[model samples]
Target: MIHRPRRLRTTPAMRALVREGALTPANLIYPMFVREGISEPTPISAMPGQYQHTLESLADAAREAVEAGVGGLMLFGIPAHTDPTGSQATSPDGILNRGLRVLREAVGDRAVIIADLCLDEFTSHGHCGVLDSEGRVDNDATLPIYAEMAVQQAKAGAHMLGLSGMMDGQVAACRAALDAAGHTDVAILSYAAKYASGFYGPFREAVDSQLKGDRRAYQMDPANRAEAMIEVELDLAEGADVVMVKPASHYLDVVADVSAQIAAPVAAYQVSGEYSMLEAAAANGWIQRERLIAESLTSIHRAGARMIATYWAVEAARMLRNSL
Candidate 1:
């Protein structure tokens, strides 16, 4: 009886005080979709509550997140056109860049603005990079475009560029480009251990992705754990201010591994499919939605993620605040 551990679980107050990972609004980053040539917000079919926002609506939402004390806002763009090279990804007037501008003007410096630096949303072929004549993604050819895109995103007022593209040397290329363009102050958030996961299906719908083939060529294989360390190490060497592991809940081991070795802050994404599954279960009355959300986020943090990119950021932030 003297050794009973039930004392901690007996009271909500005891549980709160004993929690190892305290998830605050400061630890959450809200990911959003912004579309060009849309007057009204377009609801994403796969993500019931999320929308491909118009400039006005995107700004409004950024302000809302800022008000909620969320740490950052990540912007993904959908353009009116697509091309073989994903040209708009580097354009100053690109939807992502424009959304960055709108967010800056809307929220000022209240929250960090992180741009999704990838081509899948803009390319006609739906791949993350331009295809060679043989139709394989040309990795070296993609670097220059990514470099230019980084400079443009920096000019657009992104506090940090989320390099989601899995191209080799991308972190170096983007860091060089940002510094050369006098954006030395802007940071890089490298998706160092991104897996080619089935969980991205809902994200494809959210961004209006036109991709016909899988990104397995560049993205890490889901089965590989050791390779994540290699990727994370390379990214850190190449000047990534922060490093990330994607599909966080499924890859907490990778998150924990990366965190254990690096001095840089670690980030993990609870991607679209993860969000959808939780939403579906809640709608079916299978689980308490808010409790699960808080629990899942806390688990990711406990697994060593210093930051978490999630669709439920705002609501979760509010939840954490209320618990105190």
Candidate 2:
């Protein structure tokens, strides 16, 4: 009884002082969607409060994120055109590249601008890579495209590339391309342990992904935890500056495992479905929205994620700042 844990819970100050994990704006990386040929920002219905921003509005959003003291911004593009090879992804004028340029011009080193280096948003088939004669995702054929995309993104002022396609040897391919282009300074943030999970449902809508089939062939299987470590090690060996685990809430074990095994900075993506579920619960009056958001982020941090990519980054950052 003398060891009463109630002593620490007696006061807010005591609780604050004894807090084991801290969630701050510095730990956040906001994910943004940019669309081509739009005059204004358009709300994503499935993921309420998230938008597919036009160029001008994207600049505004970037500035707002920077002002919120968020650590980084990640961009995904919805292009006006789509093709089998996702050729637009490697174009400097591509929506994602353009968004990166806009953010670079607006934020001006205030926040790290990350480009999502994947083709699912641009490919007509909605696959992450090019298809073979058999209509399967040709892993080797995808490397050159990713290589070109990396250089294009680097040239567009992306401070880091989020290699989210989950292809084999993608990290090495991108690294080689970047270094060859004299973009050795641009870092690669590899989605080292991305799973082909049902949790990605909302994201497909957010990006207007036209995928006819599942990405299981390329993306990691959800049931295997040890496979995540192998993926992380492969990414590290290929020069990934940061390694990330996607749909973070369900994969904290993977996040913690990767964090323990690697020297590279660990990132966890609190993906679209994770965001939508919280929003849905809040709308139904089932949970305290603000508290849940903060707690969710705290849990990820406690699980050893050094950086978090979340739709609620700006709002969570503001809440954290206000709490202080």
Candidate 3:
């Protein structure tokens, strides 16, 4: 034959040399759920291998993740108390704040700590924002709450505040709060183009979310692409050091488009539902777990995600390091 495309795939060394995309432990950010009041961890039934940890165990988890070479850890709090205004979000004694302190102490700068700055976990209505008299989300009224939440996270020793609430002008509001509090060194990683999708179903279980309704009122619709670019621009203009797209596998186009349009670091979240799918397939022997995990992460990375928030961070990191 005149053309031999198989020549390049003939040897392992050749394949390795010609590989276009790569995944490493350094590119991963592990998401952890921390619950208040307990010495034992509770497993989330829908999401296998995921657990809600107490402060003590959570510190150990952070240490283990860092020891495994995971680059960062993302903290999500499952607060024990809830209120209309989510008053616990601004309290130093709140679960999220306490978890942040514990993780910061355990990791000791060995890994980057990014705290999920949202009120949903602490709010009685399980909405990301404060409700109006009509019981709908009030965007403007929520801004100050997020501002307070951001500052609290920063004060709790989080290196990066992950603004995942999807509220308009949230990034700017949090930035103002941080700067005003003299936390200029703390970075903001905004969830710029988060979509309202079914992929978040398992996550709701992971965090014990008491959501009464869908997040469509605030989160972006999956039908829109150009809107993602606008969200990215707004976040960047509002001083977001990083911007992210959620549910990375189904949204590579959004990730690539945002990466091309913005100068800041682009991140993608391979959320709980994504992990559970692969885990289920692997359990059924329909797919190879390790290989699929590596491939999925590599695809996100190749699509221009500078960082990936993944449930398989430690596992994928081990594979990548061992493969190297």
Candidate 4:
């Protein structure tokens, strides 16, 4: 009776003072979808509030996010055409590259702009990398293309390159390319432990992905947590400045484990499907929307994620600011 642990929970002020983890706007990165040659912001039906933004609209979006005090932004492109080799990924006029240019000019260093460096959006088949004649993801063949894409993103003024391809040696390939191009300052944020989970369903719609089959060929299986560590180690050795785990809520343990194992900064991506679920539930009066969003993000942060990429970045940040 003399030892009471409930003293800390006695009041809201006391709880705030004793809080160990927090979700701030500065820890949030807004993930945006940008398409080539657009006159209007195309609404993504699957992701209710998200859109495939035109270059001009994307600039306005970036400015709005900056005004809202979001820490960073990540860009995913939707190309008008796709080829076998995903050649558009390395072109300066590519949707992603142009979007990066627009964001850079609009934000003007007010926010960190990271480009999603992968071929899925540009490839005809919608795989993260190139495929062999048999349609298998050719890991080695994809590395060079990824490297080229990294340099192109840097050239377009991306503050960071997000290597989400999940291909072997992608980080090393990209690092070498950036160094060769004298873009030593451009950081590489590797999706080191991305799993082949069911949570990516809505994302395909958001990007208008032409994916024919699952991404299990390269993305990790959800059954193996230890394998994620191996991938993280490889990315770190290969020059990844930051390492990330995708589908954050379902893999908090993996994120925590990876954070413990790696020296690089750890990030968690709250994938589109995860966001949609929360939004749907909240719309149905199943859960308090703001509270649930903040709790989910707080859980990710508590799991040791130094940064979080989320569709609700701006909203979460606004809520956190008001709560403070």
Candidate 5:
């Protein structure tokens, strides 16, 4: 009886004081999609309230996110052109690189501007890497492109590269490329434990994916948790500044595991499908929108994510500020 745990729960202020982890706007990183050919901001039907922005709108959004106290911004580009090798990914003027440039110029060190260093959106085949003659994703062939893409992204003013390709040796190759190009300061956030989950459906729509099959060959299997540690350790050793686990809501265990063992910070991605589900549920009045949004992000943080990349970054930050 002397323990009296209920004492802390008696008042909202008391519970706030005893909170184990704090979820703030600074911990949220907004993931934005920018389309090369878009003339204006286009709403993504699959992921409501999110847009495939044009360069001008992207710049405006970057300013808005920075003003909202969002800690970082991650850009994914939908190129106007795609080839077998995903040539746009490494091109300086490609959509993602251009978006990075716009973000850096607009935000100006006010927030970290990150580019998605994967070729899926730029590949005609919708795979993360280039394919061999047999059409399977050739891992070795992809590393060099990733390296080249890293340098280009760095040159385009990306503060960080989100290496989400799940390719072997991607981090090492990119690190070497960036260093050689005098971009040693560009950090790499590797998607070390990205799972091939069913939750990526809405993302395919957001990017207008050309994928027919899945990326199971490279992405980690959702059934395996211990395998994540192996990937996490390898990416860290290969020069990943931060390690991430994707689909944050479903993989809180992996997030906790990585955060617990790794000496470095951990990032978790609250991907499009996860965002869609909550939005749909909230719209249907099945769940309380604002409270659930805050709770979902808080749960991810409580599970040990040092940072969370989410679609609701700006809105969530504003809600948090208003609550205070």
Candidate 6:
């Protein structure tokens, strides 16, 4: 009774002073979708308040996020064309690289610009890699494609590449490619523990994914935890500057474990499904929108994510700044 735990909770000032985790604009990375032919920002129905932007509109969005004090912007492109080899992905004129160029012009070193380094959005088969004659994702073949992609994105002015393909040896391949191309300054943010989760449903729509089958062949299984550490270690050894775990809420344990074991900065993605669920519930009057948004992000931060990729980054950044 003498050591009353409620003493710190007695006042807002006291609570702030003893707060263990702080969620701020500096911790957020906004994930943006850029469509090839769109003239305006097209609203994503599933992810309320989010949009797939045109190059012009995406530049404005990047400006807004930077102005709002968000730490970074992550770009995902929806190309105008798709092919068997995802040839457009390595093209300099491809949607993603174009978007990155636009953002670089708009922000001009104001914030970190990250390109999602994956082929799912550009491939006719909607897989993360090139297919073999037998019709399966060719892991070894995918590494070279990713290496080329890293160089292309770096040339496009991306500050970092979000390597989300889950291909083995991708980090080493990309690192080598980048260094050889004289893009050693561009960082690699490896999706070290990305799991094959249902939480990516809305994201497929966001990127216009043509996936005909599951990515379980490449993405990690959701049931495993220890494997996450191994993935982190491998990516780090292969030259990953940052490591990430996807679907932050569901795999906080993995996030914490990775953060604890690694010297590199750890990131967690609050994927599209997580945003949609809360938005849907809020629209139905089931939850407080602002509070849930803050809570969800704070929980991810508290769970040891040094940076978070979220759909709500700009709004959350504004809110955090206002609170301060």
List lDDT for all candidates, in order: 0.92, 0.93, 0.91, 0.92, 0.93, 0.94
Flag the better candidate by TM-score, 2 or 5: 5
TM-score of 1: 0.98
RMSD of 1: 1.1
Q: How does candidate 3 score on lDDT?
A: 0.91
Q: For model 1, what is the C-alpha lDDT against the true structure? A: 0.92
State the lDDT of candidate 4 residue by residue for 198-277, as single tens digits: 99999988887888899987899999899999999999999999999998999999999998877678999999999999
What's the lDDT for candidate 4? Answer: 0.92
| TM-score result, candidate 5 | 0.98
- Stronger candidate by lDDT (1 vs 6): 6
For 155-251, candidate 1 gives per-residue lDDT tens digits of 9999999999899999999999999999999999999999999998898888888888788889999999999999999999999999999989999
RMSD of each: 1.1, 1.0, 1.2, 1.0, 0.8, 0.7
**In candidate 2, which residue pairs get closer than 3 Å at backbone N, Cα or C atoms, i.e. clash?**
none
How many backbone overlaps does candidate 3 show? 0
In Å, residue 268's CA in model 1 sits off its true spot by 0.3
Question: Is 1 or 5 the stronger prediction by TM-score?
Answer: 5
| Candidate 5 backbone collisions, by pair | none
- Candidate number with greatest lDDT: 6
Better of 3 and 5 by TM-score: 5
On lDDT, who's better, 1 or 4?
A: 1
lDDT score of residue 206 within candidate 5: 88
Q: Could you give candidate 2's per-residue lDDT for residues 215-314 as a string of tens digits?
A: 9998988899999988999999999999999989999999999888777899999998999999999999999999999889999999999999999999
lDDT of 3 by residue, 159-259 (tens): 99999999999999999999999999999999999999899889888877778877899999999999999999999999999999997999999999998
